[model samples]
Target: MEVTTLTRVYRYDGIDLPVPPHLAGDPSALRAYHATLYPAILNAEAVDLGVSNGALVTEYRRAVGTKGR
Candidate 1:
């Protein structure tokens, strides 16, 4: 038998950030948590990237129309 631990990652503002253990498994909470770190994320959208390399991945995308404003 083999056991493996999965990690969580957040991809926002073109940067890959390691997700805090407490925020794992809760997408909305994770996003709000990230917003504290990156205020701009408050206006962004969360996009799940599923799992990759044994880690859960998510991306935050800002509104396209608000780019230049």
Candidate 2:
């Protein structure tokens, strides 16, 4: 018998992360959603870079604060 290993990816399907109807075309809601998603993005980047969560969080907060202002 032969064994083969399968590669894995942590990709998220959109179905599990649906956007709210009210937020679809609203700029403010879009901004808020972007701000909220920044942290997750940072975390993913941190994992890729093998960095600390603090740095990613700092960057996320900075970006969110500036853009969400």
Candidate 3:
């Protein structure tokens, strides 16, 4: 069987907060703003959470920067 792994990171206040392995596969990991704690990059204002993908975190910062909130 092929092995697949996903690391969930929460980027909060310029820090990378890694999600515990136990919560890695949580179904509520992704959701719209105010729907869940997990913050999708597109919904930067929705949460103060981080993401595993560095690129996504960059994008989130850019988006937030433009908003200046």
Candidate 4:
């Protein structure tokens, strides 16, 4: 049987945070877990960076305000 493994990485604050295996497949759960680690991530947007090097890269970008202009 052919087996494939998925590696998930969370890019935030100019650092790469490896996602926990248990929360890898669950986006909501993953986000919640990350929020616990980085409260700012609660408002961050998850931007999928697509797969590279057999790993899934996701970036959590904080929302920027436009000064209500």
The candidate that wins on TM-score is 4
- Each model's C-alpha lDDT? 0.82, 0.35, 0.42, 0.86
Q: Which residue segments of model 4 deviate by more than 4 Å? A: 1-5, 66-69
Name the regions of candidate 1 deviating beyond 4 angstroms: 1-5, 66-69
| lDDT, candidate 1, 1-69, per-residue tens | 998877777899889966787778788887788888888798888888888999877789886773464
**Candidate 2 on 1-69: residue-level lDDT in tens?**
986543211222221223466775563454456546543443222112222432211122122233333
Residue 44, model 1: Cα distance from true site in angstroms: 1.0
Q: Over the stretch 1-69, how does candidate 3's per-residue lDDT look in tens digits?
A: 975554444454465545555654562453232134434444454343444453223212423345355
**How many pairs of residues in model 4 come into backbone collision?**
0
Cα TM-score of candidate 4: 0.75
Better of 1 and 3 by TM-score: 1
Q: Quantify how close model 2 is to the true structure by its C-alpha RMSD in Å.
A: 12.3
Compute the lDDT for candidate 3: 0.42
lDDT of 1: 0.82
The candidate with the higher TM-score, 3 or 4, is: 4
Task: Please identify which of the two predictions, 2 or 4, would achieve the higher TM-score against the true structure.
Answer: 4
lDDT of 4 by residue, 1-69 (tens): 998886888889888876787887898998888888898899899999999899888899999987564
Ranking by TM-score: 4, 1, 3, 2
Clashes of 1: 0
